[model samples]
Structures are given as structure tokens and as C-alpha cells.
Target: MKTKLTRRLLCGLIAAPALLWAGVQAHAADIKERTLRFAFVQPKESHMGYGAQKFADLVAQKSGKKMQVKLYPNGTLGGDLQTVSALQGGTIDLTTMPPGLLVGLKKEFGAFDLPFLFNDFAEADAVLDGPVGKQFMERLPNGLVGLAYWDHGFRNVSNNRRPIAKAEDFEGLKLRALQAPLMIDTFKALGANAVPMAFTELYAALESRAVDGQDNPIVAFATNRFDEVQKHLSTTRHVYNPLMVMASRKAWDSLSADERKVLMDAANEARIEQRRVSREMEAKALAEIRKKGVLVTEVSPQERERMREKVKPVTDKYVKEIGEDVVSSFHAEIDKVRTAR
Candidate 1:
């Protein structure tokens, strides 16, 4: 009986290795060797690049080096609009951009551009990761596949003219705005002469004095060297930009189920690290911008409220355009997060 028990234990141990090997072989069979291109407008050191690289690394590791994601940063492939077009045309595999930019493709996306819509990162994350965000992605056009929402930080104003301490300070100041109607209207409502322009063309526009100011997250201001050209920075935090990681539907349709799963898993995993790096870099970037001699000013809570009031009409106009049901649901999600806190 002792010899029989010993023999059974030995046989079980011997079969374990074969079972593990078979499982590995099955997983490998579901994947294929493929390469994907990811392009964005930010530099390689920005949060966008950091997230892209992290996702790429994860894909390679998960696929046993059978997949590769090559990154193209610094608008080398073109600006956000052009990149989106490329993705739809199946010329590019992946890209990330503010959801506000997709207003042209889906009017509901304009809800994201409403000024003061989000009070903090926590609220924004809750909405974007919740049902509202999932529904928005599901409504995307046939050419795009929404993967995940990544961080782009809250936007603030920087100008060569003067600090934006009050809503009145925006009057007559020529500010470069994202090429989205809602964004232009938001700036216009605050009394600025909003000049719609692509981000890749913004630095030259500022240097040439074509636009007196621009608004972006502090990390963007520092990483893009905007402090070198702009003299003042204000913490308006008017808009919190959440970048959407998207893939070409054409490219997505060609992938195996295992490959798609790998991409989705990697994108979500990278999102956690990307948001952490973005928030962490913001303080350091603001300090560096100040050290570079840009006057940094914080808008008082009262003043921020006043600014929100000034943009109320613009928000109302867009809420109508974005559909009341959608807007109400969006605010409901935000309220749910606020109440939970």
C-alpha cells in the first residue's frame, strides 16, 4: 500500500509539467505576430508618451514578443485631427486625443468641453470610468474603437499679456484655442478673441504674437517650453482633458480575440500609471515654469465661481446641442461621485 501511494504521487507530479506546457501552447496559438503604430502630438517625455510606451511594453510581454507597438510622438505623424483621419483611413493603428475633438464625429462628445464641468481629478475619473464614458465610446463612429481614457490634466491659462485673475481679464486677449467649436465658444464667452488652431502650430503662433495666450495643463506648458514665450500662468483649471485611446476599426477587425484582449488589458493597465505620472509631474512642472520666470497666479475660489457663471450661457448652448438626456446623465454621474465623497 505504501509503494502504491508513492507511485500515484510520482505520476501526478510527472503530468503537471505536460499540462502546463499544453496551456502555454494554447495561449500562444491564439496570438499572432503583428506590429502596430501609435502616434500622438506630445513629446516623448509627456504623459501621453509615457502611457504609450507603457502599453507597448505590456503588449510585448503578454504576447511573448509576438506583438510590437511602435510610437511616433511630437506630431511627427501630424496633429490630432489629421491623425484621426489617418486612423479612419486605416493608415494608422492607434492614437490618443481629447474627446472634445471628437465633437465633429459625435456631437455628444461636446459635453466634455464644457467649462468647469469637473471640479477635480477624482470626479473626472469617476465619470470617465463609469457608465457614461462607456456609453459615449459605444456610440463612436464605425471607423474607431475606443480602448480607454487616459489623463491629460486640467487646463489653465498662460499669456504674454497679463494674469487672468478675474473673468474680465480675458477681454480682448487673443487666445489660441483648440480647433473645436465648443472650446472656441467657451473662450469667447469669457470675452477672449478665440483663435482656433492645431496644437502643432501653437508655439509659432505664440512666438509670432498671433495669439496673446493659450490654455493647457501646467505639464504641457513646461514640456512644450511655452514658459519661454509666455509670461504669465493662471490656475483656471477650467477644463479637465481626458484623452481617449483609440484604434482603427479596420485594424481592430483584423486581430485575433487574444490579440484584442492583450491590447485592451495593456491599455487599462497603462492608464493607471499614466494618470499617476501626469498628476505627479504637474507640481514639478509648475515649479519649473515658475523658475523659468513665468508669473504664476492662483485664481481664488470666488473668482473661479464667477468665471463659471460667465460661461454658463455657453454651457447651456452646448448642453442643448449635446442633448439634455446625455447632459443630465453626465451630471448625474458627477453628482454620484461628489455625494460618495
Candidate 2:
């Protein structure tokens, strides 16, 4: 009886190791070696570029060098709009774009385009990382899968006309606003003649006096060298642009469960590093813009309030369009973050 018991114990131990080995093999089998193409508008030196490279490195490492990401930067694949359309058509694998650009795909995404919606990164992060943002991403059409949100920093207004220290200064200024309705309406309500245009055409427009000014993050102004064409920079901090990293439904559906995990994990890890570098570079960029002899104005809190009041109608109009529950949940999440501090 003792001899029989010993043999059974040995057999059970051996089977346990075999079972574990089989599970590992099954997990590894799900990861197929394939290359994914990632496209973005920024150059290799920008935060977005760094994040893309980091994502590539992590994907390769985690997938045992089996899965790779090929990058196309500097809008090599075309503008933000083109990139999204390509993703839906399976011509592109992945891309990161401002949520405002997603408004055409899903009007609910316009909630993020609302100026002054988030007071700071903490609030923005809380709302975006919470349920509301997740639900919004899940609702995207045409197989677009939102993996994570990265920071584009707070957007400020810059122009060749004059310093925008107050809302009244926006009068008659031809500002190159984003093609999104909320963006166009925001500037319009502030009394500027908002000219909707593509980002690729912006520098030439500003230089040729087609548009008097434009609004973007300081990093963009510095990186794109807008300071050379525009004479004034106002730290309006009007909009907090959240960059959304997305995957094509065609590409994503083809991936195995284990492969999807690797991609999502790398995207989130890159997001942390991207936001850190973006905030750091934004500070340096603003200082450099000042040194370039561009007039920099810090809009006072009172003046900002006035500007906010001016755009209240635009905000109110979009609230119903963006849906009541989602925006309400967003405000609640933001309020939670604010009170947490």
C-alpha cells in the first residue's frame, strides 16, 4: 500500500508541471508575429513621438520581439482626419488624435472640446480615466478602439494682431479654429471670426495673413515655430486637449486575446510617460516663445471669467448635443478629483 501511494504522488507532481507547461504554450501561441503601423502628426522629437517609440519598444519586449510597431510621424500618413478614416478602412493600424477630431465620428466626443471643462490635469485625468470616458470610447463607430488618453497640455491663443489679455481683444480677429463645431463656436462666442481650417494649412495661413491667430498648446506653438509667424501668445488655457490612442477594429479584431493585452498594456504604460514629458516640455516651450520676442500675456483670473461667461452660450448649446448623462458624469468625476485634494 505504501509503495502504491508513493507512485501516485510522484505521478500527480509530474502531471502538475505538464499542465502548467501546456498553459504557457497556449498563451504564447496566441501571440502571432506581425507588424503594426502607427501614425501621428508630431515629429520624432516631440512627446507624442517619444510615446510612440516607447510603445513600440514595450510591444516588442513583451511579445518576445514577435509583434512590432512601425511608426509614421510628421503627418507622413496624412492629417488627423485622414488617419481616422484610414483606421476605419483597415488601411492604417493605429493613430492618436485629439478628441475634438473624433467629433465627426461620434458627437459625444465633443464633450472633451468644451473649454474650461477641466480645471487641471488632476481633474482631467480623473474624468478621462473614469467610467464616463471609458463609455465614450466604447461607443466610437467604425471599429475604432480607444486604448488610452494622453495629454496635449492646455491650449492657448496666439496671433499676429495683438495681445488677447481680455475677451474684448478677440473682436474681428480671424482666428484659425479647429474644424469641430465646439471649437469654432468657442471663438465665435468670444467675438473672433473663427475660420475653420486643417492643421497642416495653419502655418501658411498665419504667415500669409489668411488668419490673424490660432489656438494650440504652447508646446505646439514652439515645436511648429508658430512664434515666428505670430506676434502674441495668450496663456488663455482655454481647452485641455486630450490625445486619444486608438486601434483599428479590423486590426484589433484580428488579434488574439493575449495579443490585445500586450497592446493595451504598452499603450497605457506609454501614456504615463507621455503626459510627464508633455507638461515638462510645455514649460520650456512657453519660456522659449517669450524669448523669441513674441508678446506673452497671462490672462488674469477675472479676465478668464469674463471670457468664460462669453462662451457660456456655446457651452450651453453643446450640452444637449453631447448628452446630459455623460457630461453630468464627467462633472461629477471632476468634482470628486477637486475635492480629493
Candidate 3:
């Protein structure tokens, strides 16, 4: 009986090693070796670049180095609009941009572009990580797959003309605006001649005096070296831009389930660190810009409120276009965050 029991134990140990080897092979087979292109408008030192790099590292670790993400920064692949089109056509694999850019594909996305919608990063994060944000992602047009939401930070105005200290200061000033209807309309309602332009061409436009001013996050103003051309920086905080990380549907469909899971996991994990880096950079960038001789101005609460009230008609018009249900759900998410605080 002892001899028989020893033989059975030896057989069980031999089978265990074979079973573990087979499981390892199966896991490896679930991820294929491939390189994906990730393109964005920001330089390698910006938040977008930081997030993209973090995501690439996570994907490589998770996939055991079988998959790679190659980044194209500083609009090397093209402007945001061009990149989105390339993604839908499967010529590009990944990109991140403001949801406002998708307003043409789904008008509901316009709700995100509303001026003065979020009070701070906390309110923005709660709303974005909540259900309404999920609905927006799930309802993306057929050619795109939304992976995660990342920070772009709040936008402020910088110009060569004068500081936008009040709603009246916006009168008759020419400003470069994103090529989104709501964005253009919002600036127009604020009394500026809003020129719709691609981001890639904006620096030259500012330098050539084609537009008097433009609004972007402080990091952009600093990193893009807008201080070299523009002399005034105003803390408008007019709109908070949240970047939507997206993958091409064609490329995504080609990925194995394991590969897809790795990409999504990497994107989300990178989001936390990306936001922290972004918020931290804002103050530092502002100080750097000030050191470069750019005059900084602050918009008072009363003036900001007046600016918001001035754009109410534009907001109301878009709310109807964006669907009342969607807007209400968006507001409810924000309200929940505010009340909880």
C-alpha cells in the first residue's frame, strides 16, 4: 500500500508542471506582437505626453512586451481634426482630444463644451467618472471606441491686445477659437470675433497677428511659449477641457480581447497620475510665464458671473441641441458632487 501511494503522488506532481506550462502558453497566445500609433497635439513635456508615455509603459508591462505604443507628439501626425479622421479611417490607431470636437458626429457631446459648466477639478472628475460620462462614451459613433477620460485643464485667455478683466473687455477683440460650433458661438456671444482655427496653425496665427488672442490652459501658454508672442494672460477659466482617449474601431476590432484589456487598463491607470501632474504644472507654468514678462490678470468672481450670464443664450440654444435629458443628467452629476462637498 505504501509503494502504490508513492507512485500516485509522483504522477500528480508531473501533471501539475505540464498544466502550468500549458496555462502560460495560452496566456501568451492571447496577446499578439504589434505596434500602435498614439498621436496628440501637445509636446512631450505636457500632460498629454506624460499620460501617453505612462500608458505605453503599462501596456508593455501587462502584455509582456508583446505590444507597443509609438507616440507622435507636437501634432506630428496632424491637427486634432485630421487625426480623428485618420482614426476613423484606420490610418491612425489612437488619439485624445476634447469631446467638443465630436459635436459634429454627435451633437450630445456639445454639452461638454458649455462655458462655466464646472467649478473645479473635483466637480469635473465626479461628473466624468459618473454615469453620464459613461453614456457619452458608449454612444460614440461607429468608427471610434472611447477608452478613458483625461485632463486638459481649464482654459484662460492670453492676448497681445489687453487683459479680459470684465465681460466688456471681450468686445471687438479677435480671438482664435476651436473649430466647434458651441465654442465659436460662445466666444461670439461674449463679443469677440471668434476665428475658428486648427490648433497646429494657431501659433503662427498669433505671431503673424492674424488673431488678437486665444484661450487655452496655462500649461499650453507656457509650454507652447505663447509668452514670447502674447503679453497678457487672463484667468478666464472659461471652459474646462477634458480629453477623451479613443481608439480606432477598425484597429480595436482587430485586437485580441487580452490586448484590448491591456490598453483600457493602461489608459485608466495613467489617468490618475496625469491629472495630478497637470494640476501641479499649472502654478509652476504660470510663474514661469510671469518671469518671461507676460502680464497676468485675474477675473473677479462678479465679472466671471457676468461673463457667464452674457453667454446664457448660447448655452440655452445648445442645451436644446444637446438634448434636455442629456444636459439634465450632466447637471445632476455635477449637483451630486457639489452637494456631497
* lDDT: worst 10-residue window of model 2: 19-28
Off by over 4 Å in 2: 1-29
Clashing pairs in 2: none
Clashing pairs in 1: none
- Candidate 1 vs candidate 2: which has greater lDDT? 1
Higher-TM-score candidate of 1 and 2: 1
Candidate 1 per-residue lDDT, tens place, 38-94, comes to 999999899888999999998887776778999999999999999999999999999
lDDT of 2 by residue, 2-113 (tens): 9999999999999888666644654566798799999998777777787889889978766767789999988889888988999999999999888888898788889989
Off by over 4 Å in 1: 1-27
TM-score of 3: 0.92
Query: Which pairs clash in model 3?
Result: none
Residue-level lDDT of model 3, residues 244-322, one tens digit each, is: 9999999999998888998998999999998899889998999999999999999998899999999999999999999
Shift in Å, residue 340, candidate 3:
1.7
Q: Is candidate 1 or candidate 3 better by lDDT?
A: 1
Per-candidate TM equals: 0.92, 0.90, 0.92
